[model samples]
Target: MTHILLVDDEPHIIGLLERALRADGLEPVSAEDGESALQLLDERDIALVVLDVGLPGIDGFDVLRRIRAGGSTVPVIMLTARSGTADTVEALDAGASDYVPKPFVVAELLARIRSRLRESAGASTVLTYDGVTLDMLARRATVEGHDIDLSAREFALAEQFLRHPGEVLTRETLLKQVWELDFDPGSNVVDVYVRYLRGKVGASRIATVRGEGYRWEA
Candidate 1:
C-alpha cells in the first residue's frame, strides 16, 4: 500500500484530507506540525507528503528543504493559503513537487497526489519507447538523438503515452490523468493536443484507435 503523509495543523483540514485520502484507497499518516512531519518522514515509508505551508514551527519551506537536503526524493505537494506568486515560486524553489492553494477541491488534490505517485513509481526518470526517449527528471524529450522542445502540457501528455507504450489510452483517461480534469469542458482539447504532439514527434508515433483513443506505437 502507498503511504501518504499529511501535515497540517488544522483539525478540520486534517480530518477532511484523511477521509478523502482514505476514500481514494491510500494509507494516510499525519502530523499537525512541521517538527512532527519531519519526524514522520524518517519513521514512515511515506510515498508522498501533502504539506501545508503555514504550520506552527519550521514551516513548509523549511520542511521541504530539510527533506531535499537529507537526499530524499519523496514527492511533496505544498498546500498553502498564500496565493501569491512569490510564495508559489518559493515553495517550488524549496523543492515542492507541486502546489495547491487553500480552499481547493479535495478531488483536485487527490488527482494531483495520484499523478505524483504515478511519476514516482516509474523505475527510472527516463521513459523510452521505439526511438523516442523522455527524460522526466530533466523534463527533456529526444527522438533518434534529436532534442524535442515541448510545452509543459505536451511533455506531460507525451510522458503518459511513453509510460504505457502500445496500450490504448482513452481520451477521458488522458484528460483526467494528464490534465486533472473530470469533464471535457466541451472542446476537442485532447485532439488538439494530440495533434500538437504528433507535430513534434512523428505523426506515426502515436496512432489513433478510431472509436477508441490514442496509442503510442512501440
Candidate 2:
C-alpha cells in the first residue's frame, strides 16, 4: 500500500483526510503540526507528504526547506489557505511537488495527490514507445535522436498518450488527465496543441482517430 504522510493543524481535517486516504487503500500517517511532521520524517517508507502551510512551531515552508536541505526528494503537496500566485510559486520554488488551495474538494485533492506521487516515483515513469522517449524527470522528450521543447500543458498531454501508446485515448480521458477538467469537444485548444506537439515530436507521432481522439503510434 502507498504510504501518505498528512500534516495539518486541525483535528477534523486530519480525520477527514485519513478516512479518505484509507478508503483509497493508502496508509495515512498524520501530524498535527510542522514540528511533529519533521519528526515523523525519520521514517523511511513514507511515499508522499500532504502538508498544510499554516502550522504552529515550524511553519510549513520552514519544515519544507529543512526537508529539502537534508536532500530528501520526497514529494510534497502543500495545502495553503493563501491562493495567491506568489504563494504557489514560492512553494514550488521551495521544492513542493504541487499546491492545493484550502477549502479543497476531496476528489480534486485525491487527484492532485495521485499526480504528485506518480511524479515522485521518478525512475518508474520514464515512459517510452516506438522510437520516442519521454523523460518526465528531465522534462524532456526525444525521438529519433532529436530533442524537443514542449509547453507544460503539451508535455502533460504527451505524457498521457505515451502511457497508452497504440491505444486510442478518448477525448474525455485526455481532458481529465491533462487539464483535470471537462472541456467542450468543439474547442480547438486540444487539437491545436496536439498539432504543435506532433510537429515537434514527429509529424506522425500522434494520430487522430477522426471523431474519437488520438493515439500514440507504434
Candidate 3:
C-alpha cells in the first residue's frame, strides 16, 4: 500500500484529505506538526508527503529542507494558504515536488498527487535531443554533458518538450500535462517556466509561436 504523510495542524483539513486519499486507494498517515511528520517519515515507508506550510513548529519549509538534506527524494507537495509567486517559488526552490494553495479543490489536488506519483514511478529511460539529456528515472537533466539543476516542475516541463520535439505544445496542453491543470488559470506560469527553461536549455531551442504556443525546435 502506498502511504502518504499528511502534515497539517488542522484536524478538519486532515480528515478531509484522509477521506479523499482513502477513496482514491491510498493510505493516509496524519501528522499535526513538522516534528511528528519527520518522525513518521523515518519510521514509515512513506511514498509522498502533503505538507502544510504553517505548523506548530519546524514549519513546512524547514521540514522540506531537512528531507532534502537527508538525501531523501520522496515527492513532497506543499499545501499553504498563502498563495503568492514568492511562496510558490520558495516551495519549489526548496525541493518540493508540487505546491497546492490552501482552499484548493480536493479533486484538483488529487490529480496533482497522482501525477507526481506517476512521474516518480516512471521507467528508467534516457532521452537525448540535440545536446540535452534527461534521465527519466533519476530525474536528472544535462546539457552538453554538464549537469543542469532543475526543479521538479522544470524537469517535468523539459520532459514534455523532449518527448515531442518539433510539436507545438499549446499552453493548455503543457498546463494539463505538466501542472495537471485542466483549465487555464489566466496566469503566465507557462511562459515564466518556459523562460526559465530557455535560460538553461538554450534560447533558440524553444520557439515561441505568436498567437499559438511553444515548440521545441528539432
Candidate 4:
C-alpha cells in the first residue's frame, strides 16, 4: 500500500519501473516532468520518490532542492544516466537519500528502496542527547531551543549518531546505516556531512576517532 512517486520523462523507463514496483507490492505514481512531480508531491501522500535527473524543466537537482526547501523529508532515490562520481556526490550533497545510475539492475534498486522504507518505518519519534533533539516524525532537528535546518542526509546522519551515543561509529557503518550504501563510495561525503552536523549541533558533541570514525559524546 506504499505509494512511490516515479518522476521520469522517458515512457519506457517509467513503464519498466512501474511494472517492477507493482510486482514488489508498491503502488506507482508517474510524472513525466519535474513540475508534475512537484505537484504530485504536494497533492499526494507519497512515501518515497524515484526521481530521474534529466527532466524537461526544473531538473532533478532543482526538484530535490525544492523538496528540501519545502521541509519535506520524504526519502528520494535519484536516477541519472550520468555514472560519474561527481554526479553521485552532487546528488548526495543535494539531499538525495540514494542514487542509482541508469541501466541499473532492478533488484539492486528494489533493495535500496526497501532499505530506505524500513529505515523510515522503524525510526523513533524523538531523540534527545544533551541539548540536541531530533523529531523523527516531523523530520526536524533542534539544538538547545533553536531550530537547526538539516538536509535529508544530515538529518539521517545525526539520527544515527544520537541513537548510539558513545559508540564509535566507523565510516563504513555510517555509510551503510545513514546512506544505505553497503560499500565505500570512495567519497568524503560522510566527513563532509559530519562537519555540517557539527556546525549546527556544536563541535564538541561529535569526536573524531583519528583513524576509525566518530563518536557522540555528552
Best by TM-score: 4
Off by over 4 Å in 2: 7-12, 15-45, 51-124
Q: TM-score for each prediction?
A: 0.59, 0.59, 0.70, 0.85
Clashes of each: 0, 0, 0, 0
- Sequence-dependent TM-score of model 2: 0.59
**Is candidate 2 or 3 superior in TM-score?**
3
Cα lDDT tens digits for candidate 2, 57-165 = 8889998988876757688888998877678757765767777888999989988888777766654557788777877656678887588777657777888888788
lDDT of 4 at 83: 77
lDDT score for residue 159 of model 4: 90
Off by over 4 Å in 1: 123-218
Output the worst ten-in-a-row residue range by lDDT, candidate 2. Answer: 175-184
101-198, model 4: which lDDT tens digit per residue?
Answer: 99899989999999989977886779998999998767788998799998778888999999999999999999877766666658787999999999
Q: After best superposition, candidate 3 residue 175: deviation in angstroms?
A: 5.6
lDDT of 3 by residue, 99-195 (tens): 8887999999999899888977773478899999998656679999999998777888998999899999999898867775555668798999999
lDDT by residue (tens digit), candidate 1, 33-145: 98999999899899999999999978989999888777677889999988776887687656677889999999999999998999788647778888898876566799898
Residue 28 CA displacement from its true place in model 4, Å: 0.5
lDDT of each: 0.86, 0.81, 0.89, 0.90
Candidate with better lDDT, 1 vs 3? 3
Ranked by TM-score, the better of candidates 3 and 4 is 4
